[model samples]
Each structure stands twice: as structure tokens, then as C-alpha cells.
Target: MNEAGDTGLAEVRVDVWLWAARFFKTRSLAKQAIVGGHVDVNGGGCKPAKTLRAGDRLRIARGEERLEVEVLALSERRGPASVAQALYRETDASRLARETARAERRMVGATAPPKRPDKQARRELRRLKDGG
Candidate 1:
């Protein structure tokens, strides 16, 4: 067990810390993510019970967004997002990569044509092409 006094610092369970830090709506969700293999601590995959400490880096994915953060402090109680943001700092590279990927996905989706065909329009086009 980490005996580090609260300079707002210490090692704590990843699931608990994630909930306290407002990364998820609840501790159970964080645990689910860990078990689902979506959370990485210190550049390695970890269980929900894994201990996290100050300066340890984490890679977490929610939907299409991936977050990379360095733990700065530990907490046991849930907090506001602003306070949670203070508990960890996001890496610039991760932020940029997520943003770029999201934008590219949006562009590709927007440029793609509709897959379904309208019955009347299809018949009319066929009639014209066949000179009928």
C-alpha cells in the first residue's frame, strides 16, 4: 500500500481513481472498461484493480475518443469535471491524434453517397437508358 501523504498524491486502484477523477459516470463503468481491455496504465494493459500513482501515464478509450493522461493526484471521492481535470493532464499528441481521426471519419462519412435506392427514380433512369 502506498503510504504517501496527501500532497494530493498516492497510488490508488485504477477503477476507483477513474471514478473519483470523473473519467466515467461511475466506478462500475470504469471497472467494466478495464475488464473490457480499454484502459491502459503506465503504457501497459491493466486490470481494474491495478494501482495508479502520480506521474503514471494512462491510455483510455471511450467510443472513438482516446485519452492519454498523466496522473497528478489521487482521490477517493467523486469530483467535478474541473477538479478532475486538475487531477490529470492530457498529452498533446493524444489530443491531436484523436481530433484528426474524428475529423477524417466525419469527412469520409459526409462524402459517402446514400446506399439505398429510390424505386421510382431507379425505374425512370432504367427506362431512359434503355430508350423505352
Candidate 2:
């Protein structure tokens, strides 16, 4: 009913909107992020129950990717990915920075050891440690 052509009549909760937008797997996780100070609304900390309106700015930090997005629509219930995408618009700079950081992380991880050593590698390491 507000701007951005959103059909919803009422403002949505920040956590619910984040969940509906697929920012988090669940509303609980979104609430946790808000409480942890990883989410900022309009450049300041806000509660999970904060009402989100169209055109509001949100900054969310999830692991190595930080996102700056503008609320485009309000939805309390989660929907399909495409529909969820319509709920917010990520800033171009945020998208580019996220991609760059992801690439950097991939490059760094490419040189790291396997997450778990195989039996042969484990035996070899043990033998070397025992001076065998």
C-alpha cells in the first residue's frame, strides 16, 4: 500500500522481513543476528521486532559477506526465491564487494589443507611425528 508498489498493507517486522527475503534460514536466526548487532536498520542498531517500511536501508553482516540493501517490499511469510528477491534490492557496491571478498576467500581456501585428512595422510603424519 506504501511506496515501492508493495501490496502488503502493514509494515513487516525486521526479522520477519529478513527471513522472507531469504537473508536468514529462519526468523529465529534473523532475530539472533539482530540481537548480536550484525544487522543495522537505517545505519543504527534495531530490535528484531522493528517495523520495516519500503525504502528503509538495512546492513547485514553474514560471515564474510556484508550486504547493504534497501527494503522494496514487505512480507511476513517467506516465499520463493524470485519473490523473495523482490523484497529487497542489494546495492551494487555491496554486491561487488561481496563477490570480491568471496573470491578472496576462495583463493585463500584453495591453498588450505583438506578439511579432514585421509587415513593414509593421517598415518604419514603420525609416522613423521614419531620420527619413523
Highest lDDT against the true fold, candidate: 2
Model 2 Cα lDDT, one tens digit per residue, 25-118: 9899999999999999999999999998889999999987799999888887777888888988999999999989989999998998767888
How well is each residue in 57-129 modelled by candidate 1, as lDDT tens digits?
A: 9999998889999888887767667777778889999989988999999999999997776898899989999
Q: lDDT scores for all predictions?
A: 0.84, 0.88
Query: Candidate 2: misplaced stretches above 4 Å?
Result: 1-6, 113-132
- Runs in model 1 deviating more than 4 A are 1-6, 115-132
Q: TM-score, each model?
A: 0.77, 0.82
Locate the minimum summed-lDDT window of 10 residues in model 2.
1-10
C-alpha lDDT of residue 13 in model 2: 85
RMSD vs true structure, all candidates: 4.2, 3.6
- Which structure among the candidates has the greatest TM-score? 2
Residue 82 of model 2: what lDDT?
84
